[model samples]
Target: MDLSYTDVANRYRRQTLSILADERPLSVSELASRIVAHPSNDATNESTETQVRKARLALYHVHLPKLDESGLVSYTHETGEVTVPEGVADDLAEIAETFRSQMDE
Candidate 1:
């Protein structure tokens, strides 16, 4: 199934926030691994390289654009590096915490 950029971004937002909370700067591959290994509360068993690639594309093409538009995060495409904006770290932390809380529920 195909997902809209916004759909993919929203679905993976918590996981992205979690990774950014612990690791400020990350490459796409690093982010993909983190998402696969530590998915959100609603995650399924569809974790694989292909899934990771789709997630990565969604992040780059969909999620990151939204985050950038909101000034919540920034990335350097050439370097494959991403970082949560200074003032948005707390927001990302909250997002991560929400995932943790949901997982515990």
Candidate 2:
């Protein structure tokens, strides 16, 4: 499934915020693991390493760029480190809640 730019941006923003809320910059692999480990409403399958890999690529190549453009996150491609922008954590939390709610519905 193809995601629109806004969709991608929102996902990246929320993920970045969630990661940064922990107060540490994360490598791409670490970020991917966190995202996959994060609980969701979907009950059919759990996230796997391959799923994480796909998410990482999507976030790194597409979503991160948009988030960077919006100044919602700062990323260093060379080291695969990502930091969430200031004041975006609440919004990301809200978005994450909404996503979970939608999946439950």
- How far is each candidate from the true structure, as Cα RMSD in Å? 5.9, 5.4
Model 2, C-alpha of 62: deviation from truth (Å): 1.1
> For residues 1-105, could you state the per-residue lDDT of candidate 1 as single tens digits?
222345224646656766688787988778877777763434667657777887789888877767666666687778888898777777667666766776556
Number of clashes recorded per candidate:
0, 0
- Residue-wise C-alpha lDDT for candidate 2, range 6-89, written one tens digit per residue: 744455456555556655567777777777666751343644867788778977897777766776667888888887656665
Query: Model 2 residue 13 lDDT?
Result: 51
Candidate no. 1 TM-score = 0.74
Give Cα-based local distance difference scores for all models: 0.69, 0.64
- Clashing residue pairs in candidate 2 are none
Off by over 4 Å in 2: 1-9, 41-47, 85-105
Could you say which candidate leads in TM-score?
Answer: 1
